[model samples]
Target: MKTSTELALSLNPAKPRCTQPRRWLAAIAVLSVSWPVLVWADCVDTRKATAAEVEFHGRAMAALVAALPPVPVGGKLQNKDSVTTLGQQCRGVTGDFNLEATRFYELNFRKAIVSVAINVRQLRTDAAGLSESYGVASPNRSAALRVNNVVWTVSGSDSPLRQALVDAMDRTRLQGWVDKPLPSVAESEALASQAVPAAVAVPATGAPASNASTVQTAPQPAVAPEPLREAVDAVNKLRGLFGR
Candidate 1:
């Protein structure tokens, strides 16, 4: 006698039912299609500041330094030697400078938030006196004058330092620091320029119920054609029909 399994297989020779594999494959295909859209939706565009922005910040810093009390003499003033001393003084003032810079950066570049720290140690005064006999005394004292490396930390989805620099340039009517010339308009006019446009909304496929507006309006009922008959015939027909 044949075994029970052999007898059963012989009775029903059709292919085995295996829906699990097909269901998994379909699920994977759907996931593959959807994953990219989700990733795209989450994507953000981040950009470094242009050279113009950097120059604008430098100019603004220079202006700030100019507005403050003049550097004192002897201690370190009015010569190449003064830059080191100036940096020392600037280091003292970095806390206040950073705060102001932070505020300025925010007001200008809303999308590109940034935190800035003025590194005064890197700045050096003019090196004009290097050739003179007195210049040989100390190698450390002769360097270029600067506010030092302005550590611009760009945070958020955008670069605020770049924005701040752009705004400051516009507001101050600065021009030609970068390769591009400033706009012909005044600072006020430049500020009145429009901001970046907002993104448009998109509908999802097979979402629980679409908004009613998407559905087309129902067409109005068509008017029936009048019966084809002369006026007298129509009247007679009506009279006959109504027995009047």
Candidate 2:
């Protein structure tokens, strides 16, 4: 005797359950066609950097810039003594910069040290010889200084958004900076104006300057130093030796 349920099934002949998977796949395919990629956030706006974010950029740049020091000096590339001196100098400078970076991370991410290092390196690398060694071969010292200055300015800003805006030039398009003028201090100020929140004051002069209620510009500590002048002159003489 056929039960009522069996009789209904026989009349209707229910569709196979396997078809559900196919239906799901079809829906997913439609969605994929409509939206091919997943997007977590839009780049529509900019804001201030958290303490952690500032530390991250500051430490990362410090590590990178530190690795660049002990710029290959003296022509005797084939001499063991010269190479040994270079190694020793590199080790010393790397350790010093790494210590500064660690302190910057532990502290409030103050950028003065990083900016000083970048500034001195900018001066050192102005000679084509030294610049070529770093693979940044730019003849224009002013241009290189401008690019370095902008990086130091924005990365240390209170706004992570402003940093991202300049990262396109400092990080991705660095090679393009060899012949072109990269972003300037004024340009970074413009970016900050747009990206910084209304509640937070933006620095008018740039980083190493207070972004507090009243902006104050401090003279760069790295400039006008007798040691820097001597170091730069010495490296320039080395370049003459190598005809760079």
Candidate 3:
């Protein structure tokens, strides 16, 4: 027979077996809480790395511009055709000047084969009655840079949309914009415009026949023949003498 205490201890259910399932459940709960933090941390790290990359690229682009010869005011370094394309894109863009600027920069600069290409992805405009009512200055801009595909940008300036561009090149440095091969449309038009028509000759009408020996030429009627008139008179006199 057991003492009351021993009986109480025995009756107390054997410590519920801590099975693998319970351990797994605890692990899952811990992971569920920690996973978000880990994910957030990873996201932060990625953003920081991207920010650094952009800053480096921005600096490089700035340096390239600084090295270039000065471009005369009103004279663009990029080609006129490229500028035309940029203008077209700008005209089509609605409301966001920064977006237009970014697109223009990307088209004119980033993809260009010059010494440097700066892509300004987003920018902030301080104008009333714009889409966003809360018009606080924000660093909501992004850019992709390529000096042969090595990227760069302004730090703390990353936006999924709307940005401005700052180019560091001069007209001479940007001359590559013109150096790019002319588009086929312009070339073909130029060729077509320059082409000349083949020459052809036509014969004149009522001119003297080339073979003159085939027909007697008529005498021009400008003057009567005096010798023929005298001969006719002499013949009339000879006829009168023969009659006598």
Candidate 4:
């Protein structure tokens, strides 16, 4: 007699390949969908994330900012729409600023700059020679530099969050991120390291004073006496007579 298992197999109709792939393949496809894709652990609630979470987000934002196109010389807003769009896209991307933060940042995230920070950020440029002086058909200057308005906003404000934002700007050279092409971290660090000193104060009474003590007057060349002048003229007259 045929084994009970063999008899059962023979009685059961085989499943068609067209209807389904091998069991392993079907299992894999099912598993792939069920498995959660890897993402930032704190992407859901950054405020609760530790310092590591903040750093992760900062880096993500930096990379996002770096990938942006560079600002042309003299500064222009070429990607105003792109920025708004990117803002929209970033809401879905983890580690970057939340685009949704726009709605909630001012509402609940003021203690930190998560939402309003990048939202308030806008590309700014101070283009020179744009007037009639530049001529009727001049090409856009290549010297355009794009800077983050957020930096200036924080700079002027007394917000406790200013330093944190400033630190991000320095590390990422984010001030130029959107308008300028990406630069190496080393390049940015070097630029930030060479900080410009504060301007010297001008006198309240008037214009600033020059460092006169450092100035040096050129020495005057030796001059012949008045008698020497007359003597030279007389010599010239004597030479004329000799020629005669």
Q: Each candidate's TM vs. the true structure?
A: 0.24, 0.18, 0.18, 0.23
lDDT of 2: 0.34
Backbone-clash count (model 3): 8
Candidate 1 wrongly placed segments (more than 4 Å): 1-58, 62-100, 104-113, 118-143, 154-213, 222-236, 240-244
Regions of model 2 farther than 4 Å from truth: 1-113, 116-170, 173-176, 194-244
lDDT score at residue 186, model 4, on the 0-100 scale: 54
Q: Report the number of the highest-lDDT candidate.
A: 4
Worst 10 residues of 1 by lDDT: 129-138
Clashes of each: 8, 0, 8, 13
lDDT of 2 by residue, 152-200 (tens): 2223343433232233223333333333443443543444344331122
Task: Say which prediction, candidate 1 or candidate 4, comes out ahead on TM-score.
Answer: 1
- How well is each residue in 14-68 modelled by candidate 4, as lDDT tens digits? 8756745577798998777766443443344333333433443343344434333
Local distance difference test values of all predictions, in order = 0.35, 0.34, 0.34, 0.36
Q: Which 10 consecutive positions of candidate 4 have the poorest summed lDDT?
A: 129-138
Error of 4 at 11 (Å): 96
